[model samples]
Every structure is written in structure tokens, then in C-alpha cells.
Target: MSNFAESRADLESYISARVPLISIRSIEQDRALRLVREMAANPRRGNLPLWIYTRATGTRDLRTNAPTSDDRSWPGAMDFAATQFANRPQSTVVFVDPDDLSDDNSASRHVAELARLADANAGSIILITDNPLWSGLQRLGMSITLSLPDASEMYDVIHAFLTDHRGVVPIEWNEQDARRAAEFLVGVPEGTAINVLATIVTKGSVQRDDVEHLARFKDKHFGDLAGLERVEVAPDSQQVGGMTSLRAWLDRKHQLMKSDLRGTKLRPPRGVLLVGVPGCGKSLSAKAIAGQWRLPLYRLDLAAMLGQYVGQSEGRLREALDAADRIAPCVLWIDEIEKGLAGQNDSTGVGRRLVGQFLYWLQESRSRVFVVATSNDVRSLPPELLRKGRFDELFFVDLPDSDDRQEIIQLYYQRYVQREPTAELLDKLVGLSDGFAGSDIESALHDVGAELHLNAGAELRPEFVVEAFANTMPLSRTNPEQIDEIRTWGRERAVPAGRPPTSTMSGPQHAGRRVVVLSD
Candidate 1:
């Protein structure tokens, strides 16, 4: 059913044909054996069955060459090899030592032995090795590289291995359960993951519960993203909101990264940057994007990532990215896009180089991981991150106007009401909370609850909420030019998140209402 299996099946059909050599790679050797058998029995009429001239370099004597440690015995391999060789005496045979091939004497001796075998067998010969063997294989002219396990085939091989060799009870231990668990914890430590899985499934019967346990395991049991990833400047985007256009752009990126995609129709977006005001919803939007896309999120913390020690930060970042890729289809949320890697040209070249490496991986990668980067300042970003194809689109989440304000307020009020909020009151609160960002609205809502608690008679009503809202200073006013500069920078180069408008501002300020913004 998988691409690898389908591909391997096709490859099997060519095993005995004019194909120079065939290579089957997988950690699941049992399933690989099954594939060899099926390939050897291709049903094509008037066509010869597949024949593999597998030859070994180890001692050929039955007693001396016998394997000592594992069931993958030389005897077993020899038996299999003999069976095939007997069936096709003139089949091509390739032999390369698994050990050192650098010593000219050893190399020449091995090559001579393979040549003798090929002559006696009346078949072509090839060599496989790391360095010296490369020359040997090349001298032979016809050879194939042993490819690593493919993802699609990997699960099947593993499941088959579990069933065949590990006393797997198919009814008790199904392939679906094993595959699902493996997919869920792909990056978990091998030992820990196995133990956790054993504990879950053995909870004794149906595989459904085991799957749920994997789903609910918290950050502590599983590896922590904060501990695993790096960060950079692109001011965080969680606070940003009302970016309908931006969300749409990311949605397209999601489709591009779908697992079902294949063969060139699937081109994922390179990356995306969030341009927004200081206290706007840019950071919040990035976090919400994870929820929207139904993906795991890894926040890259540059401050936590960079180390005073040489080469450490970069090494850590590489490991982090590897982890992300191994757990593909996750969201990488990088906060404070500007400051995170802006100093690359000067004293921070090492840090800049690290960002360069990240960008490099970003460009060449073909996985489903989505990158959501938020920034308050754009001038600090490297030219590379801003390069034409780097991101799908650059969205600017400016300050909230009337409609957005209403959404923010309605969200907070509905959250507090523990039910739906009154529509009229929602509109009034939205107007009273003009200029207040999502964060500011949340703060004001909290303040209103505090105000209600401080006074026994007054319930936390819209009027009191407006009073609470009026008491706080919006971040735009609190930090004057800081937020404005951000907005100005994004004027045209960036797409707007859509404004809620200022005419709503013409109405009288709410009675006893005060606007406020929280400060660091």
C-alpha cells in the first residue's frame, strides 16, 4: 500500500532481468526476505525468474565461516546464497568485505577472490565498500549503492519484523497499532519509546487504549520542544490577531506539506514571516496557527539557543532541526524575528552563520514542518530570510481597529461569561476598547474582574469592563514611536491583517471607562 512497497514490488520484477544490480534496504530484514522471495517468483510468462548472485568475502569454509553471535549467521546467508547459486550457476556475483578495504594487499586479495568466483560462476562481478571498495566497484563498472531504508517501507518492515521474529501475536499486536505508535513517537529515544509503548499496549488487550495513551502523554514524558529547539528575533506572534489574510496564506502552505502529496504536485511554502506592531497579535497568531493546522509547535528561543562557548549554539541548533525533521509536520514558531539573528554581519557572525545554516535547511527541505516567524522589527533580519522565495508571504498585523476590537472583547467577555456574550454589549465593549490590542483587551478584561471583586455590589458588566478598559493605557500610546515605527515599516511591503476602522472612535468614550496596556 505504501510507495516503498509498491516501488520495491516493481523492483522485484526486474531482479533477474538486465538491471545491473538490485538493492533492498531496511531495518526490517524479515520483510526484506519476503520481498526477495516474491521477486524471485515474478509471474511473467516466458520470462526467467529473478536470480541474485549474492557473494560473501568472509571465509567460505562451513565450520570456520559459521556466524557466532546472531541468527543472521554466515551459514544462513551461505545456505540462502547456495540455494540461489545452485539454481543459477552462471549468475553474476558481487563481493566486497564489510571490513577494512584500504590495505592494497587486502584489497587486491579480495578483488582477486571475487574475480575467481565470477569466472567459475560465469557471471559478472562487483565490489561494495566505503573508499577502497569504491575503486573496486568502479573497476568492475557495474554496481549499485545500497540505499538506506525508505519511510514508507520502514513501518512495514518494522511491523513484519515484530510479527515474525519477536513472537508478535497478530491479533494481540496489530500492525496498525505498532505503526501508529511508531509514527507518534518517531523522535523519542529508542529505549524510552519502546518501554513506554510496551507499558501502554500491555495494559492488556485492545490496541485502541495504547493509542490514546500516546496521545495524552504530556510534555514531561515526551521530549520538551523548548529543550529541543533554538530561537531568534522576530518578536513573538502569539498576541497578534484578526489576520484573516495571513491565516489563508498559511493554509495553502499546509496543503503543500500534506503527507499524501507526492511526485511534484506538492510544493510547500519556503517559510512565512509575521510583521506587526509591538503589542499586536503577531505572536498569538503564530501559536494559533499551530492549532489551526493541527500541528505540534516548537518555539525557537534565540536567547536560550546562543552560547558564549564556541560552536555550541550552532551544534545545538543542528540537533534541534534534526529533531524537528524527524518529527515532521510540526510548526516551528520563532519569536522576535528581527533581534534573533540580526547581528550576523558584525561580532555575531557565528550566530549569523547559524541562522544561515537554518535558512539553508529551510530552502532545501522537503518535509511538512511549517515555519511561523514573528517580528516587530524587520531591519534586523538577514537578507537571506527576506529573499524572494524564502517565505510565501509577509503579513503585517497592525493595531486593532473597531471590528477586531469587538472580536477581542467578545472573546474575553465570552471567556469570562462562561457562555455566549450579549451582542449589543459586545459591540459597546468593542468600541470602548478601541486602540487596545488583543493583549490589552485581555488585560482590561482581567482588570474588570478584579474591579468586580473589589466591590461586592457591582457584577462584572460591560460598563464595568469599559471602566476597566478606560483605566488602562494602550501599548500603542504607552510606547509611542516603538509600535508606530513597526507599522510604518510594513506600510506597503507587507499585507495588512485588515483593520477594524476608526469611525467607531467618533462615539463618546465609555462612561467611567479607562484604556490601559500592560508593560514589562
Candidate 2:
């Protein structure tokens, strides 16, 4: 059954049993109301009238916004609801996101009184809110959380929408396209999905490409990222030099991310923890994943989340994670994760709490927020956070080897100089940049490119590039011990991000004697 249909059935039973209070938790208020209205119209309930209350429209019929009560205030609505529940039986009143119910406040007390009347008269009071009610109030009744639609439900929603506007605007999307668009809009609400589809139609035509454009439309809804910063992933930014294993793993995850796994027991790959040498492509890998997948990139600044007041840091972190949940199918980059997760023994205990909270979210959240947490100081991180199930994989991004260096050299060479490097120069540069990191190569090439750009009359020569590389000193040279320590831990524990070191033959291989087929 569809999520909404299942929810409707559950709600129908609650009302049929005369449950005093029903709390429907969801951000999709309109969708929840529709479910309630469907339950009210159920044959078993005898199509009971709905006493829907909103702040703007005090008490009204669910079907129409026509006010059933003249006073459009909270106290007035409460009194009206109480009177109906006390006098009339089998009455259902729905309050749409009423405030001050979070505590034992006046509004909550009023709701409690209404609940008592509801129970005595065989009526029910429905609370539609995004947040959970106070334990005292919530304990009086049942509550069900309606999460965002999954792939199958999203497909039906999209199909229905497209059917509604079949000829209104030019729609080139086929069934397959609609299904693919539904996968992208999995975490989005039905109304938002339709609005996005309408937006595409507003452009005069809905091409097949509109399916991929759904992510961008979904991104527009979440502009205010409280604790996260949007990192722009340029097309060229995906030019990661090394980490072949990590990239291949991410590619597989990307396929799963785009696939329709609606009713499956399987879930999309969680994320990877990249720990290795500094100045390598660890941080850049995060951007590469975002760029490659064409998903929005958000950087979680742990430092910025720190606050002077107690619990403030944790609150901010929660808000950020909640925001991430809302904006799913996106990459969340946490650079230098060790720094944020460190200081577990601090007096304030905030760091420990933050670590626990982050790990909990990482494990429990079903949102498709692919985390790419990079840590140069992996040893400083808590051992619990490094558990096998915490991350999909812990990759050790060691310094690039000969082949990786060559690829890195060529990548930045073409990017900066706007031309491919010569074979002889590439060989020489690769041999020269034995211990250089990917960033080191890029920086060297950038200088060479700058010189070529500024000195327009100067020709692009291997000498200029070689000179720039020769003058560069990498992190491996400056901080050899730190690099060695990271590498040592990586070799023992994590998977290598780069291709395994290949062994070369001491001499040329002996040629095998040719064999002719005996039977023709």
C-alpha cells in the first residue's frame, strides 16, 4: 500500500475505536489533512463532519475553508471544540500545528481538557504537527509519523500530476522519465514535486532532461542552511587525481542512489571516511563526488557550530543535521572531522556530546545525505566513531604513486596550461615529483600557467614547468613523520584509496613458442 493509504487506514481505525487524541506528525500538513478527511468520510465513521481549526481560520469544515465558528482565535477555537466534543458524540476535530502545545502551557491544558471531553463523549481530537507533543499530552493518545514519500509513492504522485497536465503544456517525459524523476524527488513532498513539475512546464516544455533537473528544483526549497555551507562543485572540480578505489565505490553508490529501491530491504550506501596524508585529494574527493553525482554539496563546519552557552552547540548541530535530512540526495562534506570530534575529555563535555550526537545521526538517519568526512588526524578521532558499521568504508588516501602522480600532473597540466603535457616531460615530471601530493602538483602547474598567461609572448615550455615543480616542497618532505604516522595507521586498518603498487619484472619476459592447432 502507498504510505498515505496505509496511514489513512491506521487513522480510520483510531477514529473508529474512538481514540481520544490522534497526533499526526508530518511536515506535509495539507497531505495529513487529506488523510484525516479521508478517514472522516470512511463508511465506518458515517462520514462525520470535521471541525478543522487553524490560526488564520479558527474553526471550519475540512472540505471547505468556510468558518464554522465566528471567533478565529485559539481560546475561541478550543471552547468551540470542547462544546462540540461535550455535546456531540463521534465528532473529530483537527488542530493544524497549534503552538504552545510543546509544554504544560495554557494551550496544552486546554487541549487536555478537550481530550477528556473527547474521551467521555466518544469523540477524538487530532493534532497535526511536525514535532512531537509533550510526553504528558502525548501519552493520552496514539501518534504516527508520516515521513516524506518514498520512490514508489513518489512515482504515483508524479504520474498523477503528469496525467493532470497531459496536454496543458508540452511534456516530453515518458513513463521511464517520470519514474526516474520520482527517484530524484523521493525525499520531497507531493506539493513541492508538483510545483517543480509545474515549473518545468512553465518553461514551455518538459524535456527528458527535466528529470535530472529535479534535484536543482528541490535544492531551491532549502536555501537557508543554518549550520551548513553550500560548496559549489564546478564541472572541473571533479578532476580528482587519485583515490581510484574510493571513486569506483562512489560510482557504484551513485547508481544505487539513482535507482528505485522503494520496497527493497537494501538501502543506499551510507558514506566513506577518508583518512590519510595532508594535501592529498581527501577534501577534493568530497567535491568530486558531488560534482560527479551532480548533487548539491554542503560543508558542515564543526567549528562554527561551537557556542559559548551550554547545549547551544548540540542544538545547532541538530538543526544542521535536520536541515541535511530535509535536503537529501546531497553530499555533506565534513572536512577535518578529527578536529570537531576531538577533545572528548574537555571540561564542558560538549565535544563528547557532539560526537555522540553526530554518530547517532550518521547511523540512524535514513536520509540520503552522503557524508564524505575527511580527517588528516585520524588517530585523534574516537575509536567508536571508527567502527566498521559507522561508515561504509574507511579509506586511507595515501600520497599518489607514480601512475597517480602522472595522472595528477596531466590533469592539472591541461587544466592550467590549457594543453596536454608531452610524454617526455610527463615522464620527467613524474620521476621528479616522487613524493609530491596532488595539490602540490596542481600548485606547481598553476604557477607555470600563471607565468604563461602573464607573459603572453612566452612559449609553453617543459623548462618552465620543470622549474616550477623543482622549486615546490610538499607536505611529505616538510612533515615526514606526520605523513608516516598516517600511512602506518592506514596500512594496518583502512583500505588504500589508490591503486595497489604494481611489481615490475627485473628483465623482459621470455616469448612463448607458437602452437598450431592439430585439428581443424
lDDT of 2: 0.86
Q: lDDT per residue, candidate 2, 1-520, as tens digits? A: 7778788878977887888999999999989988887776666656675789988778897766688868988878888888888788778889898985887777787788789888998889999999778877888899878878876788888889889888888889888888878767876788888888888878888898777677787677777788999888888898898778877888788888776666787776789999988889898999988888878899999988899998999999999999888777789999998878886567889889999999999988877888999998887898899999999999999889998898899899889899998899999999889999888998999999899989998888788788888999998899888788889999999999998766678768887899988986
lDDT per residue (tens digit) for residues 1-520 in model 1: 5544674555544443433333333333334444444444456422432222223333232212443223343344334444444455545332333334445566455544454444454433333343434344344333333333333444554465455434343234565555554555544444445456556545443355454355335234545553354322232223334665666666676666543443556565556788777667777776776665545667877657777888888877887777666665567878896665776565857767777878888878765567878887787788778766777777778777776676676666555444455777776677777777778887877666566567867555556665776788987788878877877888767778764234575768677667898999
Candidate 1's clash total is 40
Separate clash counts for every candidate: 40, 0
Kindly report the root-mean-square deviation of model 1 from the true structure over all alpha carbons: 11.1
Q: Give all TM-scores, in the order shown.
A: 0.62, 0.86
Name the lDDT value of residue 363 in candidate 1. 78
